[model samples]
Target: MPEFNAPLRDMRFVLHQVFQGPALWARLPALAGTVDADTADAILEEAAKITGQLLAPLNRSGDEQGVTFAAGEVRTPDGFKQAWQTFREGGWVGLAGNPEHGGMGMPKMLAVQFEEMLYAANCSFSLYSALSAGCCLAIDAHASEALKAIYLPQLYSGQWGGTMCLTEPHAGTDLGIIRSKAEPYADGSYRVSGTKIFITGGEQDLTENIIHLVLAKLPDAPAGPKGISLFLVPKYLVNADGSLGERNAASCGSLEHKMGIKASATCVMNFDGATGYLVGEPNKGLAAMFTMMNYERLSIGIQGIGCAEASYQNAARYARDRLQSRAPTGAQAREKPADPIIVHPDVRRMLLTMRALTEGGRAFATYVGLQLDTAKYAEDPDERDAAQRLVALLTPVAKAFFTDTGLESCVLGQQVFGGHGYIREWGQEQLVRDVRIAQIYEGTNGIQALDLLGRKVVADGGQSLKLFAAQIRSFCASEPPYADAVLHALGQLESLSQWLGERASSDANAIGAASVEYLQLFGYVAYAYMWSRMAAVAKAQRKQEPDFHDAKLGTAAFYFERLLPRILSLEASIRAGSSSLFQLSAEQF
Candidate 1:
């Protein structure tokens, strides 16, 4: 694999030029004096160094060897233990976690960039830290003070890892159908007994202890998702003095041999009279679990984007150096055997597509991160509400579209390398395998789409879409440099969304049928608007910095000219309806 670059210039462009993340950081009273442009720059530099220098080299080896399980113990791949130690010691895991819980309390805008770096360098190693922070967030928000005092520091410090156990053999998207059971004990704890499959970081030797935030149905609980309760299940029982006690009854029943991310431990955990603590209110577990799931969904999308980034770099580098056929116009490199493969127009098309998406996806990720930060930390209720709604609406798109584009981009990257990309030698192939999980896990991209078209768009009567459209319209009306392209793109989005939101009510399955394509349409148009917005800023301020502005303009042009046409296809699909779903007889093929 090529040495990973920080993409520092692009990161800076998104932060200072696009979001003015520093100013937003300054606005928060708690972060007023703690953050500045210089400090932020240093953090990025340090994070990038950690990712490239420490983690990048281990990616391939991790994927090949994965986690080895024997008897009751698990072992992480070679160099992973050291890399994990470096990651934890650097406090990267809790960048956005509570400062009170031994975290840096950085905003999502900053933390999300670091996440991209981790994911870009090596997703397998990144999963350990990501899941830990997610567990920390859940514990901080809902767990008792005693539980927080005991677990937060360990998780934040990376001395222990965490997992969220919600899926079982029969339950994933439909959690109401889960069969896990949690029976209360006299000492106020619960004895949880059940099986949880596809639990990431479930049992690993990377950390000393593993904490699982488990979902189970209490004996006295009501029916459906409403009756599901959340429990805190630890691999080792904690002594009264906060020391690790003997190992608990829970253990990994088996490890799944998945299509990708082979190194990251995905386990089927079996609980047999396991001692657990209640974290949140009974029957309110789904809401509590979503706090972690929402964060994971975005990160999973970035996981896809990161793999795309790694693959693109490898492929682009290979294209520039590899000699294949002669240049089309003439025998370029006449003194040598052949010209570089990049001379081909179709190759250029693939590379440019990869570049446009990987970069555009980064910007989109930052935009969503900004919304999440504002939603939680914004003081005013209205701002918070608006931001929250936007996050809800865009999240499914971010998860589905970003990953879809990411996978497509990686595939193109692989195609650029031809046979070399498919083979194991170039390391580009690893990127493809590692990223495949992002689409399947984290509630699946299909589930994400359903959430968007059904719950987010139509359920709220298109209020969120209107709120987002206002931003597009405001910038389009006043920002002339972006006026024409953005206005056109936004108009298409508004028209489609308006119709989908209306039609969804009349047909119950309309949203589901249209969701995946609708998300793609939204993503393309949204990226078109973003590219234009960045180009507008670039044009006004950076006349001398043509390198940056030109790139933005080129990407914007590519989006509008090439990618935006997909809306026509999606519009057609959205209109396809349940002719295929319910139209056929029960046994039809």
Candidate 2:
């Protein structure tokens, strides 16, 4: 079995050094009194312990055993229930929740790293808490005081898990076509009826109850997407005094047999006139769901980073220990039959590729996390507005690019392990299988590209993109060592955005054809900026922390040299326009 060690050192480097997390926390009034560098480090260290010790042990076994669904109740693999209890008791489920609702209310910048650790330890298990946390966010943001008071505390306490029920048998990405209906009653509740498929943690033995944030249409509602509304449907109805009442009408029809994260119960939820309370306004369910979906999108993006970290750790260790044919120079381990595989240049290239991408991705995720924090907590309205726009623009990128690079890194990690990587015991194959879902779900990467380009970028008249470009230009002007290369890449992305904006006005298919490549190009440039920032920080700290700083600089160099060059190809593809994509008619294939 491969060993799992949390990358606490690199995490600290990104948080405290690269991002100057502690100083930023001190500056934010919301976090100044309650959090600091020490507290942040302590939180991360404890999280590492919980994830590495409590969660990691269950991963392989859980995957092997999977979850069992029978007679509408789902049974998670052994140790999952116990582990979940331990996890909740540690206050992890409420780590970033509202303090008034039995939560710690930590900053997102801090909370996200813990999330990364959770995903690294067990993506399947992470979904249970992640979905719950997202549900809490939506409730806190849009639900009435009565609803928040009744549900938030219990959900945060982890006695009840949560799920977002949006997709159905016929409607996956297109929420406009969903047929679920809600009928209001005299007691200020609605009877919700729908069959929501692909509901993660929809029905589980881990928590006493499961809360579902469902989307459906009210009677006489408007047509299409605007006709939808959001509802809170629970597995067991809550009594007046907060006690559990009779079972609700919701039931799990079945659990999905998936390629990965098998231990997570992805259920087909059937809500037959289930009691549901209105979350926000009527006929505006999609907006309410966006609150949760956006949160899940970022969380899912971190899932990619976490899985890549695991793959890299195992592969790095394997390369160091696995004996292979003698190196081109000579055998470094003469006592053994051959030197360790790390001696080979090709193997080194693969490992460095993994390291560079994983590390760069980590920094980029952190940057986005900070934006989330600023958007929520900044005192100045203008500052908050800018942060919010940036968040809206980049959330899709974080979700898509991180997962895309994550899968690529995992493949490279498996390459380093040779045949053992393909085998089950090594766990590298599992990483590949598990990380694959992040790309498809939380909105497919294609959908994410459309959102980023069509909605966030073009729809706003490129205002958000311009705001983002200004920040990049400001950073580049500050004269980091790789500033020129970073600026060049940014120019490429900016020009493409301008060109697409002009072309899209006339051609509807333009956004669709160029979205994926545009998103990838944007992702590469973002990572490059992150690398430049990291290298600058490392260069400044080289004397005091020689080894650590040198490694940072080296990895940044590798990224710029090998990975950042992909921007050129992406730019070429983006400039090719949408004509070629449309030229081949549906029947031509």
Candidate 3:
């Protein structure tokens, strides 16, 4: 595997310099006094150590020997169990969880960086903890206090792991079609009977207990998504005194053989009348499940970013070491038979594209994290509400755009390696394979685009989009050096949003046809906005941190000159409308 190194300097720049996360934390009552720049830096530094040293070494080895399953149980690859223990003992699982429930209560702003490191180091191992974090979020938000008292501590402490059970054999995207049934029991628990597939970490040996947050339907429930209900089905039943009891009826039927992230166990779960406890109000499961889904979407987006970062690290290192050709003008390394590949203009372009996207993405993801923190921790109600609205509007964009660009960046990274990239030993191929799932899972990029364009943007009468536009306008109003460029891109995005909104109203298929392109356009514009912000900060800090700020400005220039031009093509496609998409008949072939 390519040597994995966490980009701590860039991560710090995004958090403390571009976003001023510590400043934001100082104001939020929930984070005030608990978190500071020094504290956050120390934590991230330790995370970098663990990810780069412990987890990364096992990445290629784990992939070579995927999970093994037999006799209704699954075992992870060698060293995963110990690495997971190290991860748990470090108090990472509950980093963003409630402190009152044995959690660290870290802000999302910091948690996101830690997440990126985990993914970049080893995505397969990261999923186990990632799902656990999402499960903790949903349970903390909606689960009963008694339930919290019993499960929260165990989950956060890593005595148990978590998984979300939604997809079944017959239904993947359509949760309403699920056949999982939950029958009421006189003892206040329900009997859950159904099977779920593609369940990550559904059955693993890393933790002693596994908690599955399942979606099911009640006997007298309404039709469609409204009929769904969320349940907490444990692997081992918890006794009245919080001790382990007999095993539950739930068991792993089989493990999924997948294209990538092979080290992570994707199980086929069968619940034969398993005991379950309802988390929220009856018939409100869809809404509750979303709490976890949204969290996973963002994390999966980070998964893409993580892979891109890893790819860039390996590619950049290879470019500097591989001797290929001399520079156009002169030989940088005259003593050598040929100059390093980095001397070639085309390779430099590829490397710059990878750097520009990865850095811009880090800033963009941190911005979203800040919005989440504002929504969850801000003191004022109106501020929280506004932040929540922005989070809702941008979640799909972040999820889809990051993954799309991440995949693009990975391909470019592979290109830098040429023939070496095609082989398994170089590790670039694994990145391409691993990151591909990010685009497919979590409701797929196409589904995310539709959610952004049709549901989030169009269904709300463009209200959420307007909120976002207003934010970009406010930022541009600050009058930075690149304010004009930021303003122009924002203007283009706003105009396109209006154009798409009006066109969709007249043509029902307009949104669906234009969604993917619109999302790419929005993503490019969003990255441009982030680049502008970073450039402004870099320009101001140039005197203090000359090299770092100069590099930031150079990357910002590359993004503006080379990458931002992508929006032009995307805009044209969006305006091309739905006519071409539906022209082909189903039986034409």
- Models 1 onward score TM values of 0.97, 0.99, 0.99
- lDDT for 74 in candidate 3 is 96
Cα-based lDDT for every prediction: 0.85, 0.92, 0.92
| TM-score of model number 1 | 0.97
The per-residue C-alpha lDDT of model 2 at residue 125 equals 94
Clashing pairs in 2: 228-285, 229-285
Q: What TM-score would you give candidate 3 relative to the actual structure?
A: 0.99
Q: Give the alpha carbon lDDT tens digit for every residue of 1-589 in model 2.
A: 8767789999998988988888888888988987899999899999999999999989999999999988888899999999999999989989989999888988888888899999888989999999999999999999999999999999999998999999999999999999999999998999999899999999999888889999999999998899999999999999999999999999999888999999999999999999999999999778988999999999999999999999999999999999999999987899999999999999999989888888888898889888988888889999999999999999999999989989998899999999889999998998999999999998999999999999998899999999998998898888997999999988888889999999999999999999999999999999999999999989988999899999989988988998899988988888888888778789998
Predicted structure 2: lDDT = 0.92
Worst 10 residues of 1 by lDDT: 478-487
- By lDDT rank, best first, the candidates go 3, 2, 1
Clashes per candidate, residues 3 or more apart or on different chains:
0, 2, 0
How accurate locally is residue 415 in candidate 3, as Cα lDDT from 0 to 100?
93
Q: What stretches of model 2 exceed 4 Å from their correct place?
A: none
